[model samples]
Target chain A: MDAIVVSRLTKHYGAALAVSDISFSVPAGSTLGLLGGNGAGKTTTIAMLLGLLLPTSGSIRILGHDMARDRFAALARMNFSSPYVALPHRLSVTENLRVYAHLYDVPNTERRIRELADELDLHELLDRPAGELSAGQKTRVALAKSLINRPDVLLLDEPTASLDPDTGDMVRGWLERYRAATGCTFLLASHNMAEVERLCSDVLMLKRGAIVDRGTPGELLDRYQRDGLEEVFLDIARDRRPEMVP
Target chain B: MRPALRRVWGMVYRHLALYRRSWPRLLELAYWPTFQMLIWGFTASFFAQRLGNGGAAGVGVAAMGMLLSGVLLWEVALRTQMGLAVGFLEEIWSRNLGHVFVSPLRPWELVAALIVMSVLRMLGGVLPAVLLAWALYAFDLFAPGPVVVLFIANLMVMGWSVSLGVVSLILRHGAGAEALAWTVLFGLTPFSAVFYPVAVLPAYLRPVAWALPSSHVFEGMRAVIGPDAIGPDAIGPGAILWHELAWATGLNLAWLAAACLLFAGQFKAARTRGALLSIGE
Candidate 1:
């Protein structure tokens, strides 16, 4: 069964259309990449999926529960993380994680915290306030928080945006390992084409609040007659029609 | 523990942990209430001595007690409102509302956690003032007897109602409306009859003052602590106390229900506007 299923999703901010009617599904345990430039409705779509923003019209089902009527049930098995949203600055990493663990009702909380601490390399930062951490450190802590529940589905917005190349690669590797170990479904929205190509089994390209093109990364590269997703992304973003293959 | 209560506690613990590590944050909770108590306590003493010089020592003592009680009880309402408003603001400032609302935590569960935190913060801030009023002024806020509990409880409910209104405003208008959190109750103070009886207001304003549950509470405080209660044997708070208490309770219930409705509507509006995720920004 699909971990997430969105049907006829649309959102309007006053008279302005933010997300037009769009529909897609992510099967359980698969990673799907959502690519768009700013204001392409990626954030709005993600927000609607998380039930943070009510769609003007449409329905969302996550893990077999309707978001409108039974969001809390699905929310218990899902988690979201974004660089734009932060944990409390004054809280220590451990305090933040513990609070989320409790919020998620994770049993054996301390042991789970210790395990995440080890995996996220948060030992040195556990006692330090979140506001004091460097950007890369904060990203790792945010990741740890998102995983505190051992969610079946994770929605990540720019999961590795601020990291240096080495740290970014390391986080990507950790995410790869995490998925391998847990079979967690991922819905990732990011500007990094390389990250999407490396991780996403399927890709959805959004423009002006509508899905413009979608396929596997290799298929997109071939269809656009490009060497990489970046070139394909540029073509789509610039509204260049893909070359016809006869 | 039940999962729902555990979630509420987790939210409460998040705020408590902030105070646990930060002495400044802890101290801030008590500072204003203590300072307000000191200032008002001394002012009440001066007026009492003036009344004593006029051959009304008995009335003077009673007035002093009532004034001090007014100051302390008013602080209860102020602190409770601030506690709840500031707790909600903390989530917005941290940009944590997105994370919070996305979890299994329901809107009502968040409200429950906030109510608990408000009471805890109220105690942290007001207990110090209560202790100082007793230690320095020999003013027992509890002198009005068991009815004092009812008085404080009524004020707390009123505070929560006002805070809900303020939070709803913040939700609808975003951070630009945050000043209402601190200043809204103060705007109601004159109309609340905190330092005086509703009778003292001009005829047109008396009805406005009487509309506030807090006015009834303060009026009730005066009735229980009036000059007739000079001796221990004369310390019976009569039917007037119960009459005022009933009015306060009924009004508080009405106000609380209205505030809750307003908050629910605003919360829905916030979700529609996508304000919850971007409020602080």
Candidate 2:
């Protein structure tokens, strides 16, 4: 069964079309990279999937439940994380996690919080306020928050955008292991090509509220005749076709 | 706990955590109510000494007591509204609304949590003032006995109704609507007749004053403070209490229902427009 299915997903802001005629699905346990430059409707898409925003027109099915008709069921099994968003600053890390745990109706909240804290290397920071954490620490805490419910599907928007190389690599590894261990499907919206290449089995490149390209990393590299995924990204971003590029 | 209640508990805990860790936040909860109480208490004392109650029975003490009661009870309206509004504003400031909404937390559950937190916040601010009234002026807010319960509950419900309306505006317009949180209740203060009787208002404005739940509450409060407390026009305490309860319940329920519908509508609009995304940004 697919963990996510979005068809004809569209969003509008007054005269502006934020996302137009987009469709895709993530197979269970698979990772799909959502690649886009700024304002490419990546956030809009994710918001709709999470039911935080309503689509202008589209249907979203998650884990066999229609999101528009019955979103709480899907929301109960799905979680999203983004470095751009944050937990309550005055709240301690443990307090924030416990709050989400209770919202998700997770049993044994203290036990669940401890397990996530240990895994995320947050034992030392558990008592500290969330606002005082470094960028990397905040990123990890956000990731921990996303997993507090053991969601079957995880959505991440620039999950490691502000982290140092070592911490970013560590988070990527943790996510990879997490997906492998739990068979949780992932939809990652990220600008880090290396991270995407390492984690996403398939990639969908969005530009101007529409998908312009999609393929595996190897396929995209071969098709664009580029040495790296970043080069391929640049080619697409610049709107240069393969035949036009030398 | 039931799942819905658990969700509400989570929201309450989130706000409580902030209050727990920040001394300034805790201080804010009590500062205004206490300040208002002290100022009004002294003013009442001055009035009681100067006016000398006009040779009426129990009128001297009632004059003194009414001021303290007015200030403390006004807080029931202020604190409850602020409790719900401030908690929501904090979520917007922290950029945590997206996280909370994306979870299984429903809108009604969030409002329920805010109501619970508002009650706590109301007590946190008003209790200190009540104690201060007793210690300094020997004025007991509960002097009217069980009728005080009806008076307080009615004022709180009306305050909660206003709170829900302000939240709806914020959800639709973002942080720009925050000033309404403080100003909206004050807008009704003239109508509430907090320090004076509604009969004192201009003939044209009396209907508008009567329309407010707080107006009825203040009128009822005057009756309980004794007929001579609010000039010559005060009704008897027992009859006014029952009348105030019925008016307060009916009007507050209607207002609450209207506010809830407005909030729900704005919430849906915000979600569709992605207004929720731009809240903190």
> What is the DockQ for all candidates, taken in turn?
0.88, 0.90
> What Cα-based lDDT does every candidate model obtain?
0.90, 0.89
Runs off by more than 4 Å, candidate 2: B53-57, B236-241
Stretches of candidate 1 off by over 4 Å are A244-246, B229-240
Instruction: State which candidate has the highest DockQ.
Output: 2
User: Cα deviation in Å at residue A198, candidate 1?
Assistant: 0.9
Tens-place lDDT digits, model 1, residues A37-138: 889999999999999999999999999999999999999999988988999999999999989988999999999989998888889999999999998899
Measured on C-alpha atoms, candidate 1 has an lDDT of 0.90
How would you class the docking of model 2?
high
- Superposition error at B141 for model 2 (Å): 0.8
Which pairs clash (backbone N, Cα, C closer than 3 Å) in model 1? none
